[model samples]
Target: MIQKLSNGFKEIMIETIDKLKSSDKRIALAKIAKTYGDGGQTAVAETFHVSRDTIRKGSYELESGFPITDAFQARGRKKVEKGHLPHLLEDIQAIVDGQSQTDPSFNTTQLYTRMTIQEVRDQLVLQKGYQDADLPTNQTLNTKLHQLGYHLKKVQKTKPVKKIEETDAIFENLHATHEAYQGESNAVRLSFDTKDRVKIGPFSRGGKSRVRVEAADHDFGQTFLSLFGILDMSNEHVELTFTASKVTADLIADQIEAYVHKLRSQQEVDTLIINADNGPENNSRRTQFMKRMIEFAATYDIKVILAYYPPYHSKYNPIERVWAVLEQHWNGALLNTQEMVLGFAESMTWKKKHPSVTLEENTYETGKKVEKNVMDQYEKMIDRAKGIGKWFVEIHPHQCKAALYMGLKTQ
Candidate 1:
C-alpha cells in the first residue's frame, strides 16, 4: 500500500512541475521553494525551501514559453570591459591649454560640437589605449578643467562712508545760511577761485595722430595768464579778471573792489558775501585791504562777509563748475595768442541773466611774500576770537548776523 501511494505522489509532483514550467512562473517557484517545510519531501523544496505546489505552478508557467530569467538579467547593460575616462580628461586638458594663449577663449560646448562623442570615445579607447566605460561626459570634463584653474573671473562692490560729526556741523551751518537768505533781493553770495598761471597760448603738441593742421606750426612755449574768478551763487553773476603773472593779495583786493563798484553802480544794495578756497592770497596783506573795505562798506550801510572753504576740498567751490564750463568750450583746442585766449574766456556766458565782470591785460608782480610772523599773528587772532563778536578787527552787520547764525559768538 505504501509503495502504491509513493508512486501516486511522484506522478502528482511531476504533473505540477510540468504545469509551472509551461506557465513560466520562475519567481513564484523560487518564492515557494524558499518557504517549503519538509526536507527533501518536495524536489525543489529542500534546495530552495519552497512548497511542492508552488514549484509545480512555476514549472507549468515556464513551459508556457515565458523567459523570465533572461528578461531580469537584461535590465542593465554590462559595463564596458575598459574605462576611457582618463584619456578623455587628457584630451580636455590639451584642448584648453592650446587655446589659452588665443585672443578669444573656447568652452567645452564648442569642443563637444566639433568632435562627436563616438569619435571621442574611439580616440580614448584606440588611439589613447583607454578603457570604454571610464569616459567622462562633456560637462564633467568642463568642471574638472575649472577645478584645475583654467577659466575664472571675480566681482567687487563698494559703499559710501557716512558723514562724521564735525563735517555734519559745518554742512548744517552752511545749509541754514543758504535757506535763510539765498533768494533775498539785496543779499549776494559769491563763490571765488583763482586759476593761476594757466598757459595762455599753444603749449603742448597734438599727441599720436599723424594728421596735422597748419595751426600746429604756431607754438608758444610756457606762457600763462592768471585768472581770478567769482561766481555769485545767489544772483548767478560771474566776475573774472586776468593778469600776466601769479595771483597776489593785491589782485584779489582789486577784483573785490571792482565787484563792489559794479554792484553800487547798478543801484543794487551791496550786501555781499565772498566765498573762496583757503589760498594764501585770499588771506594775505590784501586781507587788510579787504578788512578796510568791509569797514568802509559798513559806513555806507553795505555789508561784506568773508568765508573760506576747508583745505584740500576746493572742488566743492562753485567756481570749479564755471571752470568746467570754460574747459568744455575750449575742447582742448590750442589758443593761438593771449588776445584769443582772453576773448574766448570773456565770451563765455551763463544761461541765466547775471552780472559778470571780465578784466583783461591786468598787470601782476611776483616775489611779494606774506611774512610768517604776520600769518602766525593772524591765525592766533582768529583762534582767540573764535567765540566772541569782537574777534574780527572789522565786521559788517550782515557778517555779524551770519557769524551768529552759524552758532559762533563774536570773538
Candidate 2:
C-alpha cells in the first residue's frame, strides 16, 4: 500500500481532500493514512494539517460504515464569551453596574458608561483577575455590552422642554447623583413608572367598531387596570405588576417592597436608586410613600434614593419605553377580557425578554396621607437635594431609624 503512493499521487490526494467537504476530506485522509498502515496517523496529520486524533476519528467512522460528525463543528461557533469564559456575563454586569450612568436628559435607558471598551478590558484583567490572554477582545466586549443592554453615549438629549430650569441645574443634579450610585455591586438601580390604565370591555379598539354609543355593563364592567413597570437598568430584568385600584402612594411602596424582596434573592442589595417620574403619588412630599420607604429602609438596612424626573417629563423615565412597546403590542388585539390583557402583556417582549407579571386585586386608597407632624418626622429622615428637593430625595437607613424611633413616642 505504501509502494502504491507516488510523489505526484500524494499531491493529487492532497488536492482532492482540499476540494472535498469536511467529512469527505476526513474520510479521504483516513484512506490515505491506511496506505501507510503504521505511520499513517502521523503522515495524515502532518500532511493534512489536522490532528492525529481527527484521523483516528475518521478511521473509526469509516470502520463503523456510517457518517459521523464532530460535535463542535456541527454546533458552529458560539458567542465569544460562552465559548471561552462562562463567567463573562456576571463579570461584565458587575463592572457595568458599577460604571452605569443615566442620561440627565432622560432620553434613553442605555447606561452612559464612564469606561470605554478598552478600560473595561483592563478592568477585567485588573479587577476581575482575568488574564489578558483569557479575555475576549475589546470589540467582543463591546458587543457583549450591547447584548447586556448597555452602550456609551457621548451627547445628552435635550427636548424643547418647558424649561424646568435655566442652567440645566435640575438635569445636571440628576445626572450627577444617579451616576454616583452606579457601579456598586451592593447597589441595585431600578427605573419604575406606572403605565396608563387600559379598559377591558367587549370592544375591539379598531377604527370604527363600536356600533352602540354605550353598551350595558358586562361582567368585567368598566374594568380599567394600571400597570406598574420596573426595569433593572443595569441589566434587562423587568417586573410588571397590574393593579385594579388607583395607583397610590401605598401601592407604589408595596410594589417596591415586592421588587426589593425579589432582588435581594439575586444579590446583596445595600442601596436602591429608584428612577421615577414626579407622579402625584410617589412624589417627594407624598407622606405615606416616604413613610413606607423609611420603614422599608430600616427593615432591609438599605439606603433608598428617590430619583424623580422633572415635571411633565414622565415620558423620559426608562420604564416608559417598556410601556411604549406594550402599547404598540396590544394596540389592535381584542383586550375585552382580563386574560387577554395579561396574555398580551406577558407575551410582549421588552429588550427581547418577557417580564414577570402579576395582578394585584387589593384596593389601596389613593388619598391616604400621614399627618403633618407625622410627615415632618418622616421628612427629618429624608435628605432632599438642595434645589431640586422635590425631584431628587435620599433616605438613609440610619436616618430612617432615628426618625422612626423619634416618631415612636408622642412629645
Candidate 3:
C-alpha cells in the first residue's frame, strides 16, 4: 500500500490521520488500509509506525462505522490474553478450578480455593505445558484469576463444621477402612447423605442475578423438600432422590434398599460400604435406621458397613461435596416449584456428568423408632468398631438374617 503511494500522498495520509481525533484517526487509517484490501493493516501499520492491533481495530471501526466498546479498548489497554494468548483464560480456569470447590455451607458463590498466585504459575508450567519464560508474571496471573471469579485467598484444606476430640481418629479410621474396602473387588464404596431442606416457593436466595424483578424479600415458603443423595465413589455415578415428606429414618433406609437393588441388577456387589455423617435420621444410635438396614442387608445377603464421619465433621462426607456443587448450580434462579427444583438439580454436573434425579412423592412419617426388644435383636447383628460405636458399625448379611429370622434366633 505504501509502495503505490507517491511521497506527497504518503505525507498527506500521515498528516490527516495524526491531526484527527482518536475515533476519526482510526476511521481515516482504516479507509486507507481498506483500499489496499486484505493484509493492508500490516502495511499501513508499518508505514504509520502503529501497532498492527491498532490498524485491526481501525478496520473493525470502518466496517461498523462505530468505535469499539470492548472491555480491552474501554480499559485503555489490550488484555494480555486477547492480544497474545487466546487460551490464557481457559488454561487459568482449568488449573485453578480443578483444585477449587464451592463453599460447604452454600452461603456464598465464591469458591474456597487452596491456591496462591505463585502456586497457580507453578501449576500452569507443570500442568498446562507452558514454559516458565512464556507465562505471565504473578501479578498478571492474580489479576486473571480474580477476573475469572476466583478469590485468591487461603482456603482451609477442607471446610469442617468444627474440630471434635475424635475428628482426627475418625478420619484416620474412615480413610484406612474405606481404602481397604475400595481396593477389594467385591466391595462397593459409597458416600450417602441428605442435604438441608430447601423451601419451595419464590423465596429470596442470597445470590445476585441480572433479573429486573427479584425473589420475595421474606422467605414465606411453608413447603420444604429434602434431597437424599447416594454416590458411588469408584465411578462418579450419583443418584438423587427428592421428597416433600420429612427425611425420616425409613426414607433413608428405603433409598439404600433401592440403591442395593440397582447394584445387584447391574453387577456383583457382595459388600456395600456406605460413608455417612451422624445426622439426626441415620446416626449410629438410631435404632429404627439400624433395624431397617439390618433387614435390608439380610434380604440382599450383602454385607453393609455403616461408616459415620465424626460429630460436627459432616464436611468430610463425600456427598456433602456434591450438595455444595448442586446448591451452586441452582442458586442464581428462583426455585419456586418442585419441577424447577428437580430440573435445576438434574441439569447440574458432577465431574462433568449429570446425576440421576428422582422425585419420591411418598410422604414418610417422622419419629419412627425401633423398640428396645426389637433393637436388641438387631444389636445381635451390628458389630460396632471397637469404642467408636456411633461412628462405625458392620452388619453381616447372614448374622443379621439369622438373628432377626422370624423375629427370633434361628435356633
The candidate maximizing lDDT is 3
**Residue-wise C-alpha lDDT for candidate 1, range 335-371, written one tens digit per residue:** 6677777777767776553335455565656445435
Q: Rank the candidate models, highest TM-score first.
A: 3, 2, 1
Indicate whether candidate 1 or candidate 3 has the larger lDDT. 3
Model 1, position 237: C-alpha lDDT score: 78
The deviation in Å at residue 57 for candidate 1 is 65
Off by over 4 Å in 3: 1-162, 210-213, 406-411
- Give the whole-model CA lDDT for all candidates, comma-separated: 0.55, 0.80, 0.83
TM per candidate: 0.47, 0.56, 0.59
Question: What stretches of model 2 exceed 4 Å from their correct place?
Answer: 1-161, 206-221, 406-411
Query: Comparing 2 and 3 by TM-score, which wins?
Result: 3
Once superposed on the true structure, which residue ranges of model 1 sit more than 4 Å away at CA? 1-165, 204-220, 284-300, 352-357, 360-394, 397-411
Better of 1 and 2 by lDDT: 2
Candidate 3's displacement at residue 136, Å, is 68
lDDT of 3 by residue, 277-331 (tens): 8888988788788878888888888999988888877787889899889988778
* Cα error of candidate 2 at position 107, Å: 33
Candidate 2 local lDDT, 106-207, one digit each (tens): 787767776788888888888899999988778888898988888787665566657567236667877887778768788888898888788887655542
lDDT, candidate 3, at 88: 88
**What's the true lDDT of residue 359 in model 2?**
93
Score candidate 2 by TM-score against the native. Answer: 0.56
